[model samples]
Target: MELQTITIKREDYVSIVEINHPPANTLSSQTITELREAFQILKDDIDTHAIIVTGAGRFFVAGADIKEFTEAFGDYDAAFAMAEAGQALCDEIEQMKKPVIAAINGAALGGGLELSMACHLRLAAEDAVLGLPELNLGLIPAFGGTQRLRKLVDMPTALEMILSSKQVKGKEAAEIGLVQAAVKGDELMDTALTLANSLVAGKSMTSVKRALECVVQGADEALEHGLERERVKFAELFLTDDAKEGITAFVEKRKPDFKHQ
Candidate 1:
């Protein structure tokens, strides 16, 4: 499909999706639609074991396109649709079988930060800024940000960040568990790639996908239910060829060749 706002590149088993919108890289409706399409394609791409998302210039994504908000003003249904669209895209990214990593090279505010939060992993540049500043615009985060931020950090921290419209640097974000790691600007992409590779290299994608499902899909469920789901998945994995090979390799003391079955 033709994409105007994003570019997809392949590096071996990894797919790097870069937001190419200039200026602020704001998430206009067109940009969001293109992103959904790109990710949908990558989700089924067997060659792409993992994915990394980043932006083109100084801004990862400044925020959603405030200009578009004007079109929805005074129309509750239109506003609701906009919010639902953003939430659906985030939910899709969060539930992907293949891992998705956010390489935050620059500012990630409002919808940008929300998008990063939905990824399986996030690595931000030391100077990168991240926050949900929707409140500052007389609005609130409508893209699962409120829920994910609370789960990532403490409730109090999330409340404070949202209420105060506070933007934290990457280092502070890592300290609060908003991001996995913070590296220098020049090292952000390299660090993200290293992390993405480490997560899938020499590992069974079957196991990786199940583990992600247990964590992401079960996060909102009761502890008992989550454990039950994990147990069921664990037993189910044993029936797969990759799982059998992995166990045998453990006994043979050698790396198992995984076909990702």
Candidate 2:
């Protein structure tokens, strides 16, 4: 589907959603709305098993459109609403059934960093720079960055990054657990696609989705309860035809052909 602020290209079952705002690819209110719509389309696409999100040109996303905040000026309520809406978008991405990977091709600051945190995994180009620099504007990361950042790194590291507004290169970001890995700029998409395909290969979509749910929800629950839930999910997969085929193939030393059943 055509969109005003984003472009979607598909290769097999992986859909690549690129943020198309020129220059820095800043996320304005309208762009956010477009992103919401784009993601909804992907969510409904049965053939799309995984998604890679990136930006065109030299940026992944610099941040939210500063113009919106400047125009709002002192309207605290409007600003708060904007924060809530952006956070909701991040929440939607985090809760998506299919895996969403952030391919950071360049700078990802403030809201951009928050956006990356929302993805199931993040892969960045070697030259990419990431940070939460909203402090320079006398603001903070309002799009779940405060929470998600802590989850990715230690409390001290998260506090340092968010409060200091420090930018780190892609390799350093990966070293600190901000990204899964750093790849050469030219190989970013190829690396992202490879990871996306690996996630869905020879696996039942039902099990994959269930496992994601367990991991996401388990973070908030007690360990014993979470283990019990995982056990239940494991047992449930036994009833799936995909599981049967996988087990049979394993015993026969042959590759399994998963039907996503």
In the range 113-204, model 2's lDDT, one tens digit per residue, is: 89999999999999999999988889889999999999999999999998899899999999999999999999999999999999986677
Candidate 2 positional error at 91, Å: 0.7
Per-residue C-alpha lDDT of model 1 across residues 64-157, encoded as one tens digit per residue: 9999999987999999999999999999999999999999999999999999999999999999999999998899999889999999999999
On TM-score, the candidate that comes out on top is: 1
Lowest lDDT 10-mer window, candidate 1?
Answer: 213-222
Clashes of 1: 0
Prediction-by-prediction clash tally:
0, 0
